[model samples]
Target chain A: MPDYLAGIDIGSTMTKVVIMDNGIISSVMGPTGPEQRRLANKVMEEALRRVNLSFKEITYLVATGYGRINVPFADKQITEITCHAKGAAHFFAEARTIIDIGGQDSKAIKIQDGRPIDFVMNDKCAAGTGRYLEVTADALGIPIEKMGPTALGAKNPAQISNICTVFAEQEVVARLAEGVPLDDLVAGILESLASRISRMVNRLKVEKELVITGGGAKNVGLVTALSEKLGCTARVPPEPLLTGAVGAALLGKDMVGKALKQGLPLEKKERSLREISLY
Target chain B: MAEEQKKEERKKRKTATEAASKIGGMVKAAIGGTVRAKEEGKKLAYSFIVCSYDEIIRAMDIVPVWTENYAGICGAKRDAQRFLERAESLGFSRSLCTYALCGLGFDQWREELGEMPPDAPWGGQARPDMMLSSGQILCDPRNKWYQAAQQFMPDVPIYDVGLPWPMYEDDIEVSEIQDYYIAYIVAELRGLVKFLEEQTGRNMDYDRLSDLVDLGEKTWNLIWETYELRRSVPTPMGTGDAMNTMVPMVFMLGTQEGYDFFAELNRELKEKIAKGEGVVPDEKYRLLWGGGLPSWFALTDFNYFNSKGAVFPVETTYRMIEPTYRLNIPDTDDPIERLAWRWLGYWTYWFDKAKKRPGSEPDVERLIQYIEDYQIDGVVMHEAFSCRTWHLGLIWQLNQLKKIYKPIPVLVLGAGDKKSLEHRELPSLILESDIVDISSYSEVDTRARIDAFIETLESTKKSKADQQ
Candidate 1:
């Protein structure tokens, strides 16, 4: 039987899973809810079913992201920063910088030879994260998906000087009351978020070519604003949300390969792909 | 949900060395000693550390209430919140140094009740007869904290002494400004002596002062020799233990106990090194705690690093004792003159070397030197939000280090149409939190950042091994 490797990423806002056999056989993602254990199990089962594989057939599994410790059926766990660098480099091998804007926090990782050498992350604040956009979008009474397209039509973006999300919402509402266009307001918010993220990414000196990943990369407006702020074009993966899961699966594949080469037995958990009721 | 998110109690750290566990008792006794000194009609003076006045105070038979040490004790005990809130209520902004604010709050409450604050750490800091605030180049809080506290006790007089040094200049030689710096520091030390004489009605005992200064210098040399042993491959001790060891080095400067403690620690470390012991059982990475003051509440963060196979053999903070043998000083019979010379010598020891290197300051140069000497794999710095004295300019130092030390090569366009290699810096992590304010810290977020940093270190190591 071939080595069937699996990777699961239980992020703060989303859960993803990928199964690999030389290449990706299947991948699945969904919103992360209050119950992480249940959601991780559900996502992993869906990915395995797509590839017609059972839990016992999987050679090794690696879990990653914020809720990585919640996954009980994994051989080992690694941080999302490492996994994202690996997954992003898999797509763009020449990329030296990786900007990941996730739900709770954002980070900039410097990649060297397909491995992360250094990284800088946002402090304990939600001002420069996807959650900030979600909060502002909710206040604007606009769908999060439509905020991007709405921003693309702006003639002159409104100015938002507040760094606090609550104060920024007040600025948005005050600007709306003054008859500013909705498109301008949305565009201004995304631009402001882009500036915050670019400042953090600049700490790593911003080497080319850069790849933007995570749930936030799905927004074309943010990608445009960030690229303009960085003064370089950024490449986004085909499925931005799946890079972490893909990276996890890739790392698991390497573990299996290394063990096989060294003639050593791989250490793995005795996992049954069933829902754990601990949580 | 908010209640669950708020964790007031911190994780208890596991110390690697036996000497570190005894620091708590040392702190408690020191605090209690001041209170007993007051009851016995002995004069008490409020003093700050690194002021270079501990030996002089001991010579004058005056008890020093180390206000900063008490503030740190309050922070480590997790009882500083109420005092901090009191300071805020008195119109002190939270943006100011929390150590100063905590002491000022306790002073006001003590004056109002004419006793210790309720449930104060170690029976609260004793009320002082006078305040000795040092006007130094670093730490504006040292000059202002006691004066602010003195407002609550109008009877206590404040003595402000200027202990300025000539700022480093490329063109200026140490000899050009050494005399002036020493003259100013000597005058400051004599003025401090006069202030103590007037307060306590004691005559200047030159012989005792000279002997005390001698002990202080001997202790300083012992400290340097002991800590330098951390260069051992496994690093028998780490900075987590140094946080405890610093108590004697800073607080008990002229006393024989301070010198004896280092002698004992030196023996313990040597024994451990001989037996092939380390702070971590399997020390994979040796890190430098390069800059900024530590989070007094979350010192267990060091243990957290230890759990990940990272051991900090050397740190720039609180390890203020440098080798005296490396200095060139004029022979002086006066104890005060020697004290002044040593002060200037310690601060400017790295000046000549720092000036020789391009894009390198004294702090950065010291970091690079320690990195080479200790075989450090990565650098970790804490940025205490309230302390601009130590925390400011750290980023610039790190940037300069990266610009100068290019170890990792990446391709760049050369003079012709060919690609050449340009190097980058070693991996680093900066943890942001306040020194005393627990409310500003989140253990979960800090741990996540640490986890990411360790992953970077691992990948960097793997790539290096691959290249070799």
Candidate 2:
């Protein structure tokens, strides 16, 4: 029998789920929706099915991300900032700065001794987030998945003034009318968005071993831009988007052990690989 | 060529006719004024005075003059710095909103308008038998400003009209607001009229009151048009111009001339809107700005944001509270309670009802709805030095919005006065500054940092797409 653990990230746009058994990643990715409770159930069901584990067998289930509050099954909820730091620390133990650009917001967190010392988060506007890229892609009639490489291919990127997603759309439309190259426009968008991220990280006093995570980390163009802008090498974790969820699951396991040590009663089920409590 | 000249002549004639009509209305208001009443030839029955709203000023048989109009007589603009110093010496810190202190300092100087520079037109001598203040509480506590009035004029009656907070939407809050505002306005109006009767030795006139309400309604309609013009993308006026445009309302809130000027301005704005021409062209981004007044020391940061294709569609807390002025009118004899409620009811002024029980969540929801309705691209939350309310709940709202609208980006920037920028430990605050501290980062270094952030966002966008 093996021990089982689960991690869930309830993002603004999507939810991600991961299952790990004795330190080996067993399953990744799950469909999530706007409603938190519904998405939590869906992700949990999927993770349980993939591992062939029943709900009673799961030793710990942890939740993180914007919708962490709505996860009823999770034994504990940690701030996304804290979770990201822990997850990044696990991957790159010496990482000093963690820059996580998610669907709706961008955060630059300062890490010291595996603890999140300070952080800056953008939540009020949509200009520099994933939505900006999605809207720009939609307006360009390009699938969002193709934007980064296409942008990288362009030699001359047009200058886009507005970083605001809505206003940027109008500018993109106008530029298209003016016959600007799509590659250039995409590069310009990337360049403009990078400036906002730089501001967030710069506030924390940029340090070495910068690790980038979240859904946005997968873009090579942005990585190149950030590296160039910061004048320092940056690293992205494997399965960058799952970092927060992984941290959440790990934290949950720690919480369960601590609770048991403190003489708190555990759920009546035995700790086994086949019958885990998905919650 | 002769037909063209004739057409031009006809247009000039039409303009002249309109101007004459406007002048005639002013003349009528100037003549239909009332004298203040007195006891024992000088008992000073009214304790403090506030200028009336255009509607109330017209409703009363008195003239309405905004405090800004007395600046020249008080030499406020020229001596504004001096006056501010005096206020600071008296314990008003520079951190207090400059606008409120300036208004108060100017009012104090107006008390001695007769001794002003000869070039001063009005001499600050138009002593009001009564005064009224609208419920705009963006800066200092309105009640404190009211309290300060006694130092300038020991005996004039001061009345405040209650302005509700989170304007333009009817909710459960309005009934309490209406009751509070109505009581103050009615009491103040009655007190003002009673004083006038004692001085002039004549009873109040019902007919006169009816005439004033009609004038007030017209003025309000004119101001509404001014606000409507701003809805146009790129706006019909620049930020500087918008500040200036507020002058007519502040000075002549209760006058026919004020109404006519705004009406004409509205007409001009409508023409521009119809032509599809922005007041300021080449707008790239429509942004929603949240924060109190920007640091005066760092005013250029706002322009920096704007120059980057970001146009501020709505300012949080300050101007959003302005529209509450329309809710209650002084229809009763008791105007004091109405005056108090109108000024005190502003959301940010006193106990923010939004933060109790149901708390600020609903307010956040409304703000989000407003952003969506306005089609705003992003939110730029300026976490200022001392504003705790906005700074505290910002993260929660950002996370919530991110969960629902994952596409929009929320940027949080921290800024403060000159002193805060000097501290090395305040990296969170310093990094947020657009113009980095010179000692900490060179000009080149700052530019590099800003450029880097922009690159990060671009790269993030790129990487996400590649994965998909």
Candidate 3:
């Protein structure tokens, strides 16, 4: 039987889990509010039930993301920077730069020689990340998932000038009052969000073969705007949000192999990454 | 009498001219030596020194230093750019503080060269042997840079004096801080003295120590005077230049040389004021700066106000809280408490003693007292990223200040590292506004957003006066 590995990412807004069997991602799932560690186990259990797998089947478990330290069952924790780089490299192979925009923060990671050599993170505020989009969506009374397509319909997008999400919402409302077209306002919001992410990437010199991931990667409008701003195309994975968890699981597998080769006991218990869910 | 007055004016002008000339000459000489040393295939160590006050590092015997002084230097500017590039190449993320990258770049440059020149400020090497820091600023880059320095120079010692974060004035926290402050001072002083003794094969004499302490006291007095002058109408110093004034004093602290310089400055500033020559000509509103130093990229916003006759009287938590630590004297048996008291007074590491009461917090009270004593008109709060401690009670403090002192306009600017400034509209709006309606507070997001708010304030004041 092939050994299975698990990866879990506990984000501020969402929690993601990816299970890999023999180096192939078998399944992935995400739930909101996995931020609390105690609650993560329950969510992970539900995810496992959906995939018809038990925690005992997994040989190794690795945790990544902001809440990595909070995950009690993980064998080891790797920085999101390293995990994102490894995951991006796995998918794109030639990707030298990885831009991950999660719910609360955004990060720009530069990869060299298949390793994350440098990374910059913006966790201090909710300006440029998915939070900004959420706020704008709430102001427009539009579902966030529909923003990308709606924004694409914009012809003459109005500009968003605020960096703070709270402030940007007010600005969006004010613009709406000024009778700006809904599509134009949406386009402006996307452009502004892209500009913020680009600044982080630009600091790293925005090297070629960029890979964009995280929940924000689902926004096609953001991808297009960021690509145009960066003057380079960014490759988006099929399930970008699961990349961190997938990378963590892969790392866990590597760790298990190294430990077994050194004649050491697996020591850590097998815990299901799917036990954690947002809802 | 007229001739005597004219002669005195000439002498003052000459002194001012001489001071400017001396600074220029030092720059020229340092650049010349740097160029010559570079050509000689000599390597130099690039050291980054981060502290709220410059005195401790200035007192150290190291030489060939590049500080904020090189920001405008001819080739120095290019050197900083190249240094930044090399730092990015070294896998340091650009999202980090520019100052850290600059320091790393300088270090890389020295590595590219072979050995340092004999007269290189850092003992004939371009690489720093030590990184001296204080916890006053609470900038993550300072801590991270020190760690990076440790990685590069595994053998070099990195010494840091913890400046209290959450500096709330209270008996318990203050007493505990006094202990930490005194212990840190004595420990750092003893370590440095011992190092110097080993290096020079002579112990630091009591006379020299006393003299150094006395000089520090004198510099402190001058700094107080400078702050006082900033309060005067048509304030005697512009905020742009005021920020730089602390640089020389900090870098030169704990030395007779620094003492002499400050003494000269004190004399010059006194005479200038006596003659009614204001530091900031046509000063209007006098604002207080709360939190870390304004970003270098935003120094223009500060200058713009100075040019428009607005004065930033007392800036930086260090200038406000450091003098309180003087009570932590060397002669006392309870030096540790004294040190702790000093540490407790620090802006970053201050622990609030009165957490139960929202408005009646003792730390908040003490801060209010400091602001009141300074007689500030308004407060400019920079809510910087990664500096969570500073931002926690800022809104509360603003509210308290308004309740006590009749609604002074509080402008809060949200700022982050270099990349954070890309969203500049929010800060610009705040700066331009007179009364920041909390509802409108988040509109301007960029670092430059404060400028807009300041402009709005000026316009509103003008309009109000026009109505009057």
**Candidate of highest DockQ:** 1
lDDT of 3 by residue, B294-385 (tens): 44333445655565565665665435434544434445433223333333344333345355445456545555544566555456665533
Off by over 4 Å in 3: A1-279, B1-79, B115-125, B133-137, B150-173, B195-202, B279-281, B297-300, B317-377, B381-451, B459-468
Scored by TM-score, the top model is: 1
Candidate RMSDs in order: 3.6, 23.2, 25.9
Worst 10 residues of 1 chain B by lDDT: B1-10
- Per-residue lDDT of model 1, residues B212-323, tens digit only: 9999999999999999999998999999899889999999999998888899999999999999999999999899998888889888999999999999999999998887
Off by over 4 Å in 2: A1-279, B1-54, B58-80, B91-97, B100-140, B152-185, B192-212, B218-240, B294-303, B316-366, B380-468
Give the alpha carbon lDDT tens digit for every residue of B9-100 in model 2: 33321111122234323422422221122212322222112234343434443444444333222321233354555566767665553434
Interface RMS deviation of candidate 1: 1.5
- Candidate 1 scores a C-alpha RMSD against the true structure in Å of 3.6
lDDT of 2 by residue, A199-234 (tens): 767756678889999877887777777877887888
Sort order, TM-score high to low = 1, 3, 2
Per-residue lDDT over A118-149 for candidate 1, one digit per residue giving the tens place of the 0 to 100 score? 88888578998998899899889999988888
**Candidates' DockQ values?**
0.67, 0.03, 0.01
